[model samples]
Target: MSIKSKPTLQDVARMAGVSSMTVSRALTKPDIVSEQTRQKIDHAVRELGYVPNLAASQLVTRRSGIVGALITTITNPILATTIETLQQGLARAGFHMLIGETRFSQEEEGKLLRAFLGRQLDGLILAYGYHSPETLELLQAAEIPVIELWDLPEGEVPRQPVGQVVGFSNWAAGASAGRHLVACGYRKPAFFGYDDERENLRFQGFRRAVLDGLGVEPQRYKTSAIPSIEDGVDMIERLARGELDCDAAFFTNDMQAIGALFACQRLGIAVPQTLGICGFGDLPIARVAAPSLTSVRIPAEKVANSTVELLCQRIKGEEPWAANIDVGSELVARESTALRR
Candidate 1:
């Protein structure tokens, strides 16, 4: 027996003894079609191995069914989890995610935003804090729902006439870290943070909390470049050789803290005995490290889910309240920062 030609809607209609339009209605809008007709169309589709072209169907529905996402980088573990969760949430809502990485450049973000707009995306999600004037113009022209994640930029309004924003307070996250250190009885503390503005916000919060909450002004050690394990180790070594005095240090992130933990071990400095250490963003490595890192837990998955939900509501033309979601971070005291009570 010879294999038959690939089945089309016409073929399914002929097999099901219905008009092509009736078959289309049965497949696309089953509720509009009688149950018997819908079952017959489904059976015919199964028998013929007919797969409807989603793109063609979307054209008829006037829904591009795609969401454009822009972020600084994808390699970071915490960001990777956020994107994964966002994609999964969007997929459940019958939407696809188109991701673009800006590498932390405003110019690059502007270009990427233009490209996404060219694709006529259903919605937009931006991760970076800065936005170019050109990018803002494009966003205004596109007139689609845009969700800014992670940290909100200083000047931008929470919700635009055409778009929406969802984010948490970066400053609050840092303040939590400072309070944690102060509560743990670290008076002469120091801060190690990256150069990013978001990190700077955290640093400011940490500084404020130390002065206001702890009644002591903490010293700061700003990293010239991005915070990394090597930087953490180097900072510890430099501090050891200097006259600068600090009983504890709060690294900008857990990765850096873990590095400091190793450096302290090499120098024979007992953690929480002679010196204490803490970090932010309780990544997986934080928990599994030698000392089992004590850091702030930022809900990466929750942020993604909340952003997507906000975007969905915006897409449906429903005016959602300004989503200043402060999925607050909690300080998890582990062996690294815990003092024997």
Candidate 2:
């Protein structure tokens, strides 16, 4: 047969001697179709050089083959890495990523959720903290699967989860980090954290695990916005100048903890001897920051792998997934929080 315009599914069906519905099933749900017919359709597609229109298919299937993702910020290395791995995971399953930034804003997150809903996405991945009521409504009304990236404290929220959760507890990670510093012989420790909800939860864990139970109080400093190394440097300088009181400090993240290391160097103080420091996230910077900072190693890779697998499983309509799938974290001892310190 001579073809003029771009070949369509109709051409493939006619050439293969099958109906359009059979062609559709062969392409989408091949398991139910017979092998001989599937091979015939495959050969006809190759012979006719047919390119299926994904947009047209989506119009009928109501699935864009796109997964919506909302993250706090791309600048932060942790979330950046998470998004990267998430995309790779989705791509393996023939899905593309449609990403948005919330900048830790509930309103912006709600807008993104609504926009994604409008786009007819196949599913959603939220690496964010808070959600608006409108966003919740969108999720409840959505037929696709929804996953919250952060681990919600089992019973603290006083509400059921919006969807499946595939993450670890920030509080538990923070508490373990605090305990690491204390067990290393550091007393009068301080904590540096941001004003974000997740960071605040970590702070609570640190306080309960290190302060109340250990009989040591931290010189606390909580600031708004994303924490940076400068925040760590600035806080340590104040502590060095006797304006703050703490021989050691625990940071909500590695960026701040690494900052404290730089500040200690500037203040002519020795690490592990004069000051003990611990950070969360166990980011790569933690490993090369001179003394190699101690940190809570969040299983980000495992989290990514599991998140993708779990989301795909649900997308395939798999049932009986646990309410919360915890990919827990671990504490690493390093020179920064040496036992001799």
Candidate 3:
């Protein structure tokens, strides 16, 4: 099929019986054009399904009005909430969001970074933490504001980022889960989650916490792919059948923790009594899970608020009050790790 040519300002002008300048004025500054002219242009635009050229507006303003975001996935609630809030804040500040999926890989992010730079993004927000050497060079060369979200890289939770970081300590979040389990009197514990760059950071933190708090390192059961409910359930079944030697477990997130609950029910493994489970992210379901999951809470909205503030400062060529901000985290004690139960 032959493709129809895109309707331009000239085409709209022709249909409305006006000059291109008149059509532009009607679309942008309607008050400068007569009501009759605007009505004619509007009718023409609707009939032709003409869309406004946002690129032209960007060129004139020297601001792309496009903020590029690289997130692992929209399926995960933590990243999804932060991305949605970031978009809303950017929109309020007269910017649009263009998102790229990275799936927590530096390689995937590197490709998306190149594409975003080609698109002339005004800023970038990243959910994934790792950056390849080439990706770092590209970002440094681009000289645009980049906000790294989610977690700090290489146990640099307290280190101020060179660009800007709007995240908490992934290690610390995981550590809290481990420490809480130890406090609940669990002698043996396991760590089950995705084996990725950031998840490794969590694993490290959890191990340190478990070793220090209970003098025992957690048994690691990891997947190279993204951790899902199915992975959690299957891992739990294995543990239930005496496959993994651990009495309690801390998962990377609540989905897996809840799945473990199902496995326990199926295998008649008593939670807290025989097995204690803790999770990260403190998702809503954690509170309502069969035994109420113990989890670490990251403040998504609070992080978004800080991210937008930093972006706005950078956009206006002003230094932020602080280059890196730790939004902080909390541990939600729940029935799953109850000491009395």
Candidate 4:
């Protein structure tokens, strides 16, 4: 039951009938070794299951071979999917991910940023909006490639920069959502959201579209400081109590929509009959829910891929276009808001 020992460079060198230095050169600097010798070293390494020590190699290269990811929360499904995609894509490019969650707190984000700065991270990926000026300054001074996702800043991109960013326009996506809801015949639609700045942008877009396109002013919608399943349930309960009134509702994210759906079921409110529900982020659970959720697909994987690509380019001293880039979102309709028969 003892664990087997890891095969070392000496084992491969012995099997290949070559010096350890020669085997190392064949594995790392293949150009310095003959093709025949390289092939022999490769075969020996494969037979012995000898893997290169990345940490040791990184010491000489002065690169950590690791990427730091700062996220608002770990429990968010959409963010989880995006991070998963990013990790997979980064791994393919010979990089590992070091994750830190801030729970959507600026103070926590600053602390995490400082901690990661001490590490040997080659790059940084932020999942939420940049709000901390100190953290931004540190990132700029570090000169490492930094990519921001999910949320984009409202004002002009700062001149003192870190690296490239790949994200979608949250305001535009919200406006699109508003248009879709209005086109689908929702007049008295309400927005259910969190107090985050990005969510505020979406709310503003929704308001603008409803006022301009629909020519109707939406009533005050139910919102919470923290958008979670429990908050969703509380909002629905209040609605049942006649505190809120709406024929259709737009949730900040799919998690809240799922919560609202469950609450509707518990209250015996016929979905898309007595009320309609829509959410942002086309999470997997959205499809599995009863009367599948109608939501906006955020292109999480594509954003992750593009972010890593841009970061790599920046790391290589390649000048990319703009620091900020926006990808578009798509509206996916499902039974939650299906047309009435």
Best by lDDT: 3
lDDT of 4 by residue, 1-341 (tens): 99999999998989999999998766555557887888899899889888899779778877777889998888888888888999987875657799999888888888998899888788999887656788877877888888888775553442332455677767777777777677777777888887667777888888888788678877556565455777677778888999998878889788888899999999998888777888889999899999899998888888988888888777667887566777778888998886644
User: Where's the lowest-lDDT run of ten residues in candidate 2?
Assistant: 151-160
Q: List the residue pairs that clash in candidate 4.
A: none
TM-score (all chains, Cα) for each model: 0.80, 0.83, 0.82, 0.84
TM-score of 2: 0.83
| Per-residue C-alpha lDDT of model 2 across residues 1-341, encoded as one tens digit per residue | 99789888999999999999999878755667898999999999999998777788888876778899988777777777788899888876767899998877888898888888888888899886467788787788887888888666443663356778888887888788778777777777777887766777777788877765478666678744665778888888888788887777888778888888998988888998988888878899899889999988887777777788888788888873566788888998888989962
Output the number of the TM-score-best candidate: 4
lDDT of each: 0.79, 0.81, 0.81, 0.80
**CA lDDT, candidate 2, residue 37:** 96
lDDT of 3 by residue, 84-140 (tens): 899888876757799998776778888998999998888888776677889888988
Model 4 residue 287 CA deviation (Å) reads: 2.1
lDDT at residue 44 of model 2 (Cα atoms)? 97
